[model samples]
Target: MRSANPARHVSLPFPRAPRYGPEDQAAVRDLLHAGRLSDTSRGPAIAALEDAFADLTNTVYALSFASGTASLHGALRGVGAHPDAGVVTSPLTWISAILVAFHAGSFPVFADVEPGGVNLNPATIATAGQASAVLVTHTFGIPARMDALTAVTGVPIVEDCSHAHGARYASRPVGSWGAAGCFSLMERKPVSGGEGGVLTTNSRTVYERALTLGHHPHRLAAELTDPALRPLTSTGLGYKTRMPTVAAAIASVQLRRLADRMAASETNFARLLDVLHAHAAPITTPLVAAGSTRGWYGTPLIITEPVPNPAALFAACTAAGVPVRPLYEDWLSSPLLQDPALLHEAFPHVRHTGWRPPDPHALPNYQVARRQTLLLKVPDVPAADYMHQVGDTLATVLTQAIR
Candidate 1:
């Protein structure tokens, strides 16, 4: 093996998102020129965005929100994650999952991720004990084992498909499988606005409840089908969580091009993997379950076998200008979640949650996975043949160690 190939190394860009094209620019311009932005009603762009999302997820209703967090909160609450009720969810996910539980005034039941997986283990959800709702995030754009999860819990499942815009499980779109699905259209997600979110559901009751939680009465009055909830149209839970019309316009343009973007990413990712293997680098692709298709947000490459020092690889990659970095801290072990004292200090009225900290040793897979992760920052709209350069960069970085 060669000592180095600095001359041949590719210059790959680090993670950055919220790409805009001519179409996105044009759409935003059109919306701005129209001068019809308002919270009084679901604006035309937002309504169109909702329709696009509903079509993508195959759901009956899709409600836009100011952000993913708000959408998730609405979804959990819509499906009965209220005070004293337990919401079963993975600890190895974004804090929003747990925060949504708090937002709903519910206890969050922390469940372990499956061994050798980044998603919640179905067995753990089954054993979590009487959860009123289950919230699932397709962590890092890889779809969780939805079939197993649905099989275990009778509770309404609210999917946090923030990381997974176009990802699928069992040949079905992720957000559609659950009772309600929540998505974030953040800068870095697979499909994004500058900042926005959407909640999708089939049930009329769930949709209405979610709409009421974040949206205003004006929309509620127009859209509310349930006669009983019509009275609340005057106020609609007193919270304003609608996505800005301009953001909706930008997101709608992105949504239209989502399929093509995904296809390009898939090609780039496959070629990049081949390039890695060609050099025999000690890194593996992400783990996706059977019948699953990932949107490939940022590829979480793992290091296993032949045991090249993980730290050395990270440093070499960094020094050689490879677009890779160490994985983030484990969400499950973070003091932010474990310290109930913090919760008490922050919210005096809220007490008593199903917040059981799992034994770290028991989640051996996640511990090892997090420790071994190399976050390869793939572009949202991939550059033509850019992945080949990324492969070359990583190969050069690992040349000394992989040998």
Candidate 2:
């Protein structure tokens, strides 16, 4: 039923973690010796990371958080999300993107992504009715149609730049196009610190609000300009989502090395795509919109033909040492939104309002994409020999499976 190739093997490991060099080790060692690991003690590492990130993204403010989810929640609160407001966002994203709305006491309205594209369609967003805010995700490092989306919607826009830290659309960085942009530094991300996140924004109000929500009460008061508001510092209105000093140190080093890593990833992606095209492989790669530069998180491939037994293909790929898997394979349904019991427990306000769950079947594009697409993990910098082997393995397995 299935073909297996035991001889062919990919030398590179799957999900390779970032290696710490002398600079990373020195930063951590310095932090440990200082015994001031907390940001409250004016930790130089965290402050330095914030400043570096702000400068890199060309944003006025960059606030670090414990995780990308925390940063998203903070960004939502910073943009004035209320219980009565609805946030229009793409459903084809990480569950955390949707959960942040619930954490902020805001309702999430699903918007369908464009055909053959991972980002939300501007037309779909426009027809989603009145929304207080719109969240755009540059899914898989491909820049969304920010210009058109912004022009169509008259509301606060937040860019989910977790997979698109260095990606650009029309020569402008993703984080600069919206009211605020959120990034992740988790282990799997292109640039990671093991675990951390950052929110960048040009708006001072948004920055101040996010800082107030993420930082400690005493620290928030010290940074506040309004004398009257300073009194409220005894009990800050926000949660504790501050980043650790050590993680910041790691992230700073990774940020500095992002350009080179991206270049290598881009080159490898081009090489693989070329191999696939040259051999007339039956897998389609993700399309990059004009003037948009992808960060190349992972190469997305769409099966061009229907396989009689999909599991056989997967088995073959796995046996051949190819890190091939279903796209968004972990999620079956949109959480909370799809589960009424969980939604009621998490957000009690929804029970009284009588909410209706979005029909997954209605999202034709998302459904088709999910079913047809597979993700291939490529190393940041792959060896030429490794690339050749990968190309041969993919072409062989896919061709066999299709027949």
Candidate 3:
């Protein structure tokens, strides 16, 4: 049985959407009235959005898609991994990170994550030795060690920036460091547009290939003529996964305010970390790499306890009204991956190339991750003193629960 209490709310209860305003509403209305919502090479609005994204990420080209998973699949195809070729990635990410490879007709080889809790370590990747390409996820907006990864794999690298929007490594933007970088604009990400995604790259060839692989017919206005790609574009079928005009508009508005939003979120996160530390929460907040500026999608903490029952702690927090949620809570227990019909239709090779959870007790990183975590939503435009209540609620709830 769950306790019912209003004074101890789990999180702030503001009704307004963050980072959205009159401008975003107006942009949506404009696209809605246009009635031509699909993305096309000639759509001026879409082109403008793409150009804006490219500039923001400091990349030569940016392509819009319906979701981050689509962007990842397109990137895999752009790098030319065949159906049977194994591509390496971390299992600790959202299942989509692995599913994207299977969708591209490639096998997703799992790698172990580091103590930092981002993606797999570069040294581990180097030793895997079977992967044809590496797809690294910046889990929870923490940048993976790109320098070490690039040095070890020496293969085309794709960065899953789904959790990292404004993150950087050694003064370089996350997307700028990889062969291709992908971002998500889902409801909970740094830039929320309901649902949308973008893929960026400096390589003209990779951009053109990803565009074709994503199944978008090039409009004359997009200026994407590559003699080498015409035939491939003609024969390939796309996933019909371009971002809707309205989603793009919403994303564009959020993108404009991303920097300020990130700054506030960082401040909120640091304050919360301090509170947790003061309470002796028995958890380690994520370590931001030197020379890296973090854009936290979710603030991750590691519980060093050998067998921390996060479910029990989460229940206790909820009973006290902290509005806490897990980052990827008990994902292995979900049935979607096991559903025969769904798996067969969406991932035919799942039995052979499917995802499997590591033995939690045996995995050093998983053991570290088993500690309780809470994700507090940082509104796009936060109230001046909201962090005070958030930090206080968390400290109170955690102090009572961390036995």
Candidate 4:
């Protein structure tokens, strides 16, 4: 029987957002005092945030959007994805990544992920047939093999950097590898603004197109070369997905503290890994490719062998007050992705040609890994005592489950 009070067993919540400090409070206060609560035009705060983020990612331009989905919508459109165009991507990612392609009038084709990793295998990309573009996700803060992926597929790549804010590949940042990188500043992200997103790009055309897709009509008009076309900007072609000034203000403050947060997370993650390895548990720690610096999204513990009853392990962990879950359990089998009726209602235009649901049998690696992976939430900066307790708890739970 499950305990009536789970709180008595667990010390902390499974996942908790970083607490805001005086800096965040001061930013909000300043925004309120200015009397400009909401402005369509890229206000001072928004512009400053874009500039700061662009500099951080080493990109020529950065555009803020209402949400990560909105940013991805603009990015897909900006990269020239059209109806019937095949966008090859990993099936192990969030549903939003696949949905963004459908929203952009592009069909998503599944690419198998690396055997033991959470990222798309570059080799499997070609199997998706003729791909117009590729959407690569640095899943769970581990950087994908961008250099290899780009070398193999000459098509444009849009990186989803939502989970990998401070991650790096081969000494370069994750966002810098793709044609345009999209990031989320949602509540759970490392550096959040409550709800906001940013897209970074080095290409002027991609930047202009993304701006036209999300920026206000007036902002779009100013960037237009032809004076006659400026008036047409008022037509409701744009998504009206510009990030609010208040959110931008909060994001700016968060961005400044990203380095410290990343450093702390890395240290804590290393300690946990050490503990897990020392115990010789039948689990695989997250694999970091050579020359890559992975930021911690969550601690992924891959079970070495399939348990007789996986639910029992989860139940035990929950009862013990340790929150754990599958990293992503067969996302391809989700009703949202497979239900033609639901998909048709959501994207009516794509029903005819662009909507092709992925075959679950096609991606063997994704199928195998999805079931074996379990996620553990680690604080950005955990105390030594807390981590030791967590590590000990995890080891004990696994041992009991196997026995």
TM-score of each: 0.90, 0.91, 0.86, 0.92
Put down candidate 3 lDDT per residue, 1-403, tens digits, no spaces: 1112312443556323535679889988898898867865547666777887788779998988889888898788778765545788876688888778778887667667786465677767765546667899988777888888888887789999998888898778998888899988888777777888889999888777777765556642244578877765544455677788888888888788889878776666666566556555566756677988876776665554432566777776666655456667433344654455665676667556434433334445644564534454554445434555555565555555565
Q: Of the candidates shown, which would achieve the greatest lDDT relative to the real structure? A: 4
| Clash count per candidate | 0, 0, 9, 0
Worst 10 residues of 3 by lDDT: 1-10
Candidate 1, residue 368: Cα displacement in angstroms equals 1.7
- Pitting candidate 1 against candidate 3, the one with the higher lDDT is 1
Candidate 2 CA-lDDT value: 0.78
Output candidate 1 Cα RMSD. Answer: 2.9
lDDT of 2 by residue, 193-280 (tens): 7898999999877877777776887677677665645665766675778988989998898889888878877777777777667667
Candidate 3 achieves a global lDDT of 0.70
lDDT of 4: 0.79
What would the per-residue lDDT of candidate 1 be over residues 3-94, giving only the tens digit for each residue? 24533555545433448978898988887788866557877898899999999998899999989999998898688786666888876677
* Model 2: per-residue Cα lDDT at residue 36: 65
- The alpha-carbon lDDT assigned to residue 225 of candidate 3 equals 73
Instruction: Return the clash pairs for model 4, or none.
Output: none
- What is the number of residue pairs that collide in model 4? 0
RMSD of each: 2.9, 3.4, 4.5, 4.2
Instruction: Give, for candidate 2, the lowest lDDT window spanning 10 residues.
Output: 1-10
lDDT of each: 0.78, 0.78, 0.70, 0.79
